[model samples]
Target: MKIIAGLGNPGKEYEHTRHNMGFDVIDELARRWHVTLWKEDMKAEIGQTLVNGEKVLLVKPLTYMNNSGEAVGAIARYYKVDLDDIYIICDDLDLPPGKTRIRKKGASGGHNGIKSLIAHLGSENFNRFRIGVGHPQDGHTVVEHVLSRPYGEDIQKIEDAKIHTADSIESALKDGVDHAMNVFNPKRKG
Candidate 1:
């Protein structure tokens, strides 16, 4: 079984905020796949489905952002899923809005959620699908920037990124992670 977990704080106030980018992408995928029924399991909301004959679990952790691993670890253990089959979606403050990136393995890059995942999983070998939320600008703290919703053009940019993230995950499911990375990852100008 494949586990696709999206990191976010669970609450109406957190909806569509920059910090909830992971949840936004999962919600997009769920909508596209018609996964309307979500059940609580392992401290998370789970939507089950099949993609290319592979059983997939769409998970939304309810342990908030900082402690997401508690839920993810439990689900992974319960299902006996391999680390290679786990995909984590989360927001990235390093990249500008409207961009996304896929990494097979990496450190958390200061993301509390990913940090928790690494702590619980006992490895940094799972897949990551990151949506850029941009860095905190002006006098705004990182917390304020992430907890708030985007405005004006940034709002549209984030919405587009969410759709792109979902498409990339679908591609990863159908083709392979390498193929998805090649297609979705932006080229760096060196």
Candidate 2:
């Protein structure tokens, strides 16, 4: 994979939201790569770095979560990157907080960012790393919960997941998606 797009909305208001888990992972990756991802082109924040000596583009879409495809598709086209060489990191509500999953390719499972990606890019073949943020609680709507900040213990869990997500991305770069999946995909608690 030559491109890694972390899914999230732009703006400080969305920084700590559960929906921004993808951005958190991207920030962690940027720190690891020693690159700040400050570039303001392609409708996203982009930076170039090497993972395991493999050149990779790290992207944080500024198109907001629902329209993330605009930035990602633009980057892919600009770089002439193959669709198969793109990967995404995103939040997943189906799993428990802190858990993560990796997939070679799949449906969006109702993730608007991913759905937009499939529509814009015309493919679901790109790899994805899903960070589990858990569903809303306390009668909060899904939108309310995802946009709200996590509290207490959930904070640490999400933070840990970011580190692990970076590690998983590195593994995918060095090895392959299957290897990353085996190494990083957490077992469910059910």
Q: Compared with the true structure, what per-residue lDDT tens digits does model 1 show for residues 1-190?
A: 8999999999999999999998888898889888999999889999998888999999999999999999999999999999999999999999898789999999999999999999999999999999998998779999999999998789899899999899999999999999999999998789
lDDT of candidate 1 vs native?
0.93
RMSD over all Cα atoms, model 1: 0.9
Question: lDDT per prediction?
Answer: 0.93, 0.88
The candidate that wins on lDDT is: 1
Clashing pairs in 1: none
Q: What is the TM-score of each candidate against the true structure?
A: 0.98, 0.94
| Candidate 2 off by > 4 Å | 187-190
Candidate 2: the clashing residue pairs are: none
Least accurate stretch of 10 residues (summed lDDT) in model 1?
A: 24-33
